[model samples]
Target chain A: MSAGLSIAREEWRLWARSRVVLLAGVIVAVLLVVTSALTALRVADEAEARAARQASAEATFLAQPDRHPHRMVHYGHYAFRTPPPLAAFDPGVDAVTGQSIFLEGHRQNTAMFADARAGADLGGFAGLTPANIYQLLLPLLLIIIGHGVLLRERESGTLAVLLAQGQSALTLAGGKALALAGVVGAFLLPVTALAAYGAARGEPALTAALMVAGYGLYLAVWAALILAVSLWVRQRSVALGVLIFVWLLTALVVPRLGINAGSAAIDAPGKIESDLVMLAEQRKLGDGHNAADPAFAALQKQVLEQYGAEKVEELPMNWRGVVAGYSEKKLTDLMNQYAEKRMAQEAEQSRIVTLFGFASPTLAVGAASRTLAGTDLATHHRFLREAEALRFDFVQGLNDLHATKLTFADDAKRSADPEAEKRTRVNAAAWRLLDDFRFVPDPAAARAARAALPLAMLLGWLVLLGGAIVAGARRLRP
Target chain B: MIPALEARSLSLVRDGTTVLEDVSFTVAPGEIYALLGGNGAGKSTTLLTFLGFLAPSCGSVLVNGRAVAEDVDGARSAIAYLPEAASLYGHLDAYENLGYFLDLAARKVSRAAMDEALDQVALPREARGRRMQSYSKGMRQKTAIALALLRDTPILLLDEPTSGLDPVAIDEFHDMLKGLADAGRSVLMVTHDVYGACQVADRVGLLRGGRLVGSFEAAAGERIDTETVHAAFAAREAA
Candidate 1:
């Protein structure tokens, strides 16, 4: 153990003295941190702008004059996106997913204006996150630093001397691994600091901890594998080349293969198709303009009977308001069902993706990060659900006000008489009664639970690589 | 008494091809034994077998009565190997590389002792502090000898140690080997230069067809000539 520590210390001293190693490590750390912090700020600004637009849309909806509740249902309401507070750590698929969802009486609208899969064909490769640094590029750097550990000694004819000195192959390997892990730790420190910073700001502490743990485990695999390959090869050049190949295959090749395979397995319906389907479904429900239809006429008769009215004018409630309330209820239910189905399809797609986390810890961590941040597909779906709920409440409230305040005769005649229509406008007090959209993210406890599986996989990797250390050490003995 | 280094009927087959077969030789303490052969004569192969770098397909290599392949570290600890071109970490200065090898060899000599070892090999004091990447061939060879001295092993194996040295350095290297022998160490040297072998070796062995086909002992009034040695090497090749 003392020998191992001494060797570890020696490696660190060498690295410190070697300008190239120190420069490479520092440059990568600085670049990743700066890029991550800047990107986080940019995303936060975008989210704020989106929220402001939502506020303006809500204000516009409230400014409307009094009208039949059914007409107000046709006018609809816009729901703005509420960005997750922890999204600065990892945006997940938030950029790729739609933010705002327009909810109306009859048709469901898929969230639109997502930035994912945007730009030219090659643009999608560089996802917006510090994860790429940890996942793809970091291993390559480890390979560069670690591949020559044993082979160089052999090439220089120093292995015999080292062996003669009571240094077992296991000891040498242990020392090298210790050295590499130290370098990997230095590389991860800055990113972990960023994550911890987010965690410090009331970001889910457990999720942040898990993220750090997962990344560390993943990089450990690289370090051990690098040493293993270096020991297995006869020449230092071959060792370096072989390790680079392994890194490329595992980090870049396999992940893209997994993502493409998942997409091929279950392709979600395109947005255009979803919109057309929602439209077709809405037409099947009773249209508000078709008052001659039996369903509409029956609804009107029911309202009169329920109020115990002798005639339309004798009724305290406006007939137009009653028509609008009934219209809003039917269409809102239709839109909600459509939404539920689309969200289900998206859930299916994401479920397939999450299963692949086992094959690649990167996928697992990516999923867990997004889920914890409330920036994953599920969160987007929830936001849409809440937005639709608010839309329903707003449209329905207007319908109820028309039914109670305006007489049936007054509502029916107001559409034809501009003067009466102007007088029928509801007071500002009524508009104030409409609720504003509020987002309640899934609880932090639930996020930690959601991240548990990936965290466990990451832990499993750490244990497995630790085992590799023992196994590789045994093989190195003369 | 056990030979300082010995191999009997040793064979090395790599990738289904026999590179060496039925190779046998022995070196006793206080003797400089030379292994002479043409290109591809397996001189380096025979030396590597003693170090256990290549496993023998048949028979065995023994260092001080222990099979080296079975006790690699033990055998390696007892010997120093200087390969052709002598690859020291080019990024490390001569002194640093020497320090590293000595450390590996389990020797804990002081920094001053390391400097003295380099001085014994006639290395320039100024060059000791510069990285080896800038060293000339003679400087590199001297540093390798300096490493061997610092290791203080009982046996030494040199593969073309004087290949690129100047006449002065080559003479100096042979004297160093002779001095090592006088101190009761054994040295096995492989070289293509027959004249140098005759000058430095107490006994010269001719390797042809992966076997030691001829050997001559050094004695008073019996100095081996280059022509006779070359003729013997060619005859072994023809046979």
Candidate 2:
């Protein structure tokens, strides 16, 4: 213990003298502070804007004067997903996935207003969030700082001196790791403060804690690996070169290339393709307005049988509204089937990309961090599904009003006869009965559950690197 | 008393080739022994074996009468080793280097004692606080020697200890070795300088092609002859 601690102390003393490393550390600390504060402000402003827009959309729909209920269904509403509180820290897929959906009848709209669509580098490093600093930059900084820890000693012949001082190779390795851990902790300070701020601002405490834990483990993995490689290699330049390559592979190359490959392999249908296919299928269901259309012959007869009437005038309520309601159910079913298949493919792609985490702790911590932040793929999908549900519910409510509120004789010739058209309009107060679109984000337990495997993968990396350090210590050159 | 350091028929093979072949030597308490050899003649390899950095391919190397292979850390604990040129951390001052190394040895010394050791090595007190990166080769060597002195171990192993020192510094270093020997500490230093080896050693061994080909010893209160040992070394290399 004395040997290890002394080694660690000496290392710290040496680092204090290294101007370049110290300067780099100071710069990174300041960068994290400035970027995280800016991100918090952006998130707050975005949430407010989305809420305002959602309210405006609802007001616009309800403000309409008396009109055919069918017209209200076409007028539609909007659902805006308020940013998750922890988005100030991670932001995850939010920048690429969009936050608002246009919820109209018959058509299930994709989310609009994604930053990626606005040419924001797909939320790449150009986006500059705190999560990027933790996932990408910290490990690279550690690599640059500690790559030569052991090699410098051996090259300068100090390793022999230390070894001859009765320091076991294992102890020397342990001491270096302890010292590196100190540096990693120092780097984590700003992020730790960010976590505290988030918790104070009402983000889930467990998620913040886990984010902190995941990042710590992620850096520890890099530290152990740096020591192990330094112990194994013979030269400082070689260790630096090898570690940089490793950093590049883990932090950048694998994640981008692997996700792209996974997405390619799954071949999920695009929004345009799915929409075109649905339009074709909807055509088979025919136009819902014309009760004389052959597509509704069976439905028209069914209504007539129920009423024991031979024709439209004999029915008490308008038959067109019943047909409109029935046709909508079929179209929504088609929309659901396509939506579920697309979501399944998207989920599969995300799963495959997550499997790449096994190769890179950076990816593992990234996935876990985003999940805890409630900005992951599942959350985005949840928003879409919920918006669709509200779209279906409100559209059908309008259809029910259309059927029971107006007479068949007035609705059929309303276009040609002004009096009939005036009689056909329903009360303007009917829009009040519609359900509002409120986004329910996944619970903390669900986020924690989804993050479980990625966090475990990070743990697995730490353990694996730890095992390498132990095994490599024995092989350390004196 | 058990020999302070011993190598009983030590031989080492690395990468399918032998570097040391059946070499045997010992230093009694208070004795100064030097192994003289040219490059790749295995002088450093023998010192490494005593420190247990390299396991013996055959035979045994021991320190304080314990088999080094069986108790390597114990062997290392009993000895202080100074490598060729003694490259201390260029970013650390002499005092910091000594303190760090002494800390690694799990021993603590007072600042006054550290000053005393540095004074004995003739290192400038002003330079003791400056980073070694600005130090001359001789100053760095002096700092390493001060570190070895501070270790206070019963046995010392030095590989090319006087490589960068001037004639005056070399003389001072040889005199220090004699004083250490007189105080009953054993030393085993490996070097190629015939005069330097003859100047300090109570006994000397000549190594050629990884074999100990010749040996010399001084009478009581005397030193080995440089000319005779140098002649023998040249003859063996020529053969």
Candidate 3:
């Protein structure tokens, strides 16, 4: 242990003396801090934009002229999903999912316009949060530094002298790993502070801690792999090439393949197909336009009988309000069922992709980061579900007020007379009863549990790294 | 007493090519043995196998009576090797490079001891503080010598130790080798410079076809001239 520590210290001494290593490490750390600040700013901006939109929507809804409840049902409400606080750390799939969704009685629209990948190189480069830096950028830098550790000794013919002087293979490997670990730690500092910040703010501290652990293990894996290759390959060039190839495979190729496989396995309906299908289902269930439609007419008859009225004019209640409420119920059910089916498809796709997590921990980590930040597909789905439920409640509440309060003859004549329609409008009393949109973050424990799979893969990588150390040690004899 | 370094029928085969075959020799304490050979004559190969950098196909290499490949560190600690070009980390100064190698060697000597060792190699005080990349060939060679001395191992291996040096530097290098041997250390070096070998070696061996074909003692009695040594080397190359 002492020997390993000493060797590690020596590595630091050498690393410090090497301007390139020092520069690279400093550049990485600076980039992390700058990116963290930028990500926080971006998330804050997004929150503000969404908040303003939500306020404007509420104001617009309140400013509407008095009208029959059924006419108001078609006006709909717009809700924008505000990102959770921890999202500033990871911002996961938030960009890919839409931000605002338009919801109305008898119709559902998908959340639109939130994808992060919509822009050019600037957008791609803009997503360099601390976690992204650790996952993709840090390993490659480590590869450049660590791949030549022992190979340089051999090249210079000093390795033999070092061995002659009683440096054990285990000590050598351990020391080199220790030295590289320091570099890795330096790179992780910004993210670690960010994690601590999240914890202080009462976000998922445990999840943040797990992220740090995962990243450390990931970097350690690279260090070990580099050393192993350095020992296995005789020349400096060969060792470097092998390490670069491994980095490419793990960081870029595997994740892309995993995503492609995911899409192939569980194909979700395109937005257009989902919209068309929902429209078709809506027509099938009930349409207020077709009075001859059995489902619609039956609903009308049932309401009339309940009110003890043989004809629509004789009823004190508004018939149009009753019919509108019934149609809204049928359409809401259909949309919910379709949305659930689509979510299930997406879930299946995600499950298939996560199967590749063991091969590439970055994908697993990326997903976990997004999930913890409440910006993943699941979070988006939750927001959509909550917003749709709220829309149903608000529209239904208005319909109920219209049915029992307004006279059927008055509501029918309101359609022809502007002043009568104004009289038929439900007052602000109904609007005040409906709730505002609220976004809930995923629980801390749940985030940790969700991150478990990636953590396991990181552990697996640790084992593999340990194996490489042993194997490399064995090969070091000659 | 056991030889400081020995190869008993040591051989090496790589990718179906015989790089070294049945090479046997020894350098006892207070002795200098120069190995002379043509290009690809397996001189460097023999040294690497002894250092446990290359695994021998047959027989064994013993440093201080222990097989090198069997106990890599034990064998390595018993010897210091100087490659032909003596490449050091270009980014590090002489002192820094030496410090790093000493650490790798697991030596606990202080900075003063390292400087003392550099002084023994006759390296100029100014050169020791300069980056090795900016060093001249002779200066780099001097640093390699200083490193071997700092290691203070029983045996020293050199591949063409005098390949690139001025006459003054070459003479100084020979004097250092002699001094090391006089201090009861064994020196096994590969060189074609018959005159330089004669200056430092107690004996010399000729390598041909991956085999040590001839061995010559360099004592005052029966001492050979540069002409005879050159002819013998030429004959071996032709053969």
Which 10 consecutive positions of candidate 3 chain A have the poorest summed lDDT?
Answer: A112-121
**CAPRI verdict on model 1?**
acceptable
TM-score of chain B of each: 0.93, 0.96, 0.94
lDDT of 3 by residue, A53-108 (tens): 77777777777765566666676767777666666777777777777887677677
Q: What is the iRMSD in Å for candidate 2? A: 1.3
Q: Each candidate's lDDT (Cα)?
A: 0.74, 0.86, 0.77
For residue A170, model 2's alpha carbon misses the true position, in angstroms, by 1.4
Chain A accuracy of model 3 expressed as TM-score: 0.91
The candidate that wins on lDDT is: 2
Please provide, for model 1 over B15-103, each residue's C-alpha lDDT reduced to its tens digit, 9 standing for 90 to 100.
88778888788899888999999898899888878877678999999999999878977888888777787767677798778766666
- The two-chain DockQ for each candidate, comma-separated, is 0.24, 0.81, 0.42
RMSD of each: 4.3, 2.1, 3.3
Please tell me which model should have the higher DockQ, number 2 or number 3: 2
lDDT of 2 by residue, A372-418 (tens): 88889999988888888888888899889888998888989999999
Task: Write down the lDDT that model 2 would get.
Answer: 0.86
